[model samples]
Target: MVHNCVFSFKLSSAREGIRSEKVRELIPDMLSSYTVNIAYHANNPDVGMALEKDAGRYKLFNSDVGLFITLAFKDKKYTENIIYNKLLSDKLDVNLGYVYENVVAQMLIAKGNNLFYYTMESKTSNHLYEIDFLTSVKDKICPLEVKSGNYRTHKSLDVFCNKFSNRICNKYVVHTKAYKWENGIYYIPVYMIPFL
Candidate 1:
């Protein structure tokens, strides 16, 4: 089996201060089922190529948009096992949930060509916010806001929703619990993504 996982982080924040809590939550499952692959944005093609050449042999996929990976698996059952383990683990964090949201978005992109994924960058005074994922399905752009805890109205999400209401079909806030579609947005838990 082959699994392609694309993890995205907001680049507006300082690289060092951006917490690894999200990556920490994802690493165990990714490492168990398939060899881990990672990709990031590169401003220079020559530098990106140099890094890839030094990064060793693996399945690498690149595009004008950004960097990404394609993971080849020796077994499929490990997928289920890793998921089950992640559910049982109690160390999960909110930052980790945001990372998982990107993983889920990439998984959806891998499943079909009709869908397009992008990240949103916005500014408010001196503060900047980058939404985890923006997906276009059936010509409608859906902005996804990731939360690790109980679902609630978020200020950033609200701001994005209000600002892009004309372009966005509905804003989605993904969490770790159940799914709900209230108002014009969808509140979906991580486990329901494969089905959605």
Candidate 2:
């Protein structure tokens, strides 16, 4: 199921160990399922500018936003239908970052952009700088960070753009906030993702 894939992906990407073989196998199977359903395909961005030989580093998305919305609540028979209406009306108390991330991924996919993200590995510590999404425009990469709230500390996006300034076109923080320009990062509303 897509929920399991999302959980597994989040765990692995967060550097948490997945001990179950069944859980490991479900990830690829979910990828294939999404592809077969014409929803989305896997995207693997290289750790650096140059392409890496390994395809292990990747992200999966739902190409259809509607399908993704439905997939999010597939587990609960009673609550599944309720979430859709509540989420649309901004009534849900639960954290909506995963939903927003999925929609952003869907929008990027619809725009014909491959879903890619950047993360810097730390040698001495577990700390890492992670950009939520990356897109190429005019020969430069644009880094985006998705947030569910107005809390505006974007250290990852800042560090990434700073280190890769010459290779970056723009920096963005997508959230529920209205449009604003601050310290070079554009804070845009979630609905405006397609226009970006």
Candidate 3:
């Protein structure tokens, strides 16, 4: 049998100032479909070591504070090149580079089988926004925006949502917090990822 799996991590103590009841409730159910593995980074070196060692095999989720699920999968050739180029560019700082690397790495792990990261020419601008990742789930193409902060306002996500709203059921804003839905877009906290 083919088993679809997810590994989750908690990154926050509360959501919007209240204790996260949804996070508490959803975590156990999220674990039910996959082989569950849990760890707290505060006390566990093993979890960090494991994540770093096989970073390609897990999907990362963040509660609110830190890195969550570490996704497992294979890397595509073109995406690897984009990541490499970004790393060499003086524009991205170390923290930003880490965020991009981790996001791309997690994406490779979660949707490696179906997605490709590419750059597409925008009709309005000669410059390109590195088309980060693409995957077809249930025959619909899903585009993802990888960002580090909890804030969800993103121009790329908005563009993708508007352009493909009919064809795409959902667009993801993967970040370092818990999931929420606003204006039909799914704001997925990195900790609660691969569930949708």
Best by TM-score, which number?
2
Give candidate 2 regions above 4 Å deviation.
Answer: 1-50, 80-82, 122-124
Top model by lDDT, which number? 2
Model 2 agreement with the true structure over 30-65: per-residue lDDT tens digits: 656655111221233322433542234445556566
The TM-scores, one per candidate, come to 0.49, 0.72, 0.44
Task: Tell me the lDDT of model 1 at 101.
Answer: 44
Model 1 C-alpha lDDT per residue in residues 10-72, reported as the tens digit of each score: 422535553445544564576455343333321121212323221211121222111221122
How well does candidate 2 score on lDDT at residue 56? 47
Clashing pairs in 2: 39-63
Tens digit per residue, CA lDDT, model 3, 1-196: 0011222223343224433454445556764543332221211111123323221223323322122222221143224444446544634333452354354445445543322333334679885443344545564656667676435567766665565566564676666566777787676765555555
lDDT of 3: 0.44
Return the TM-score for candidate 2, rounded to 2 decimals. Answer: 0.72
- Alpha carbon lDDT of each predicted model: 0.47, 0.65, 0.44
Q: Please give the lDDT score for candidate 1.
A: 0.47
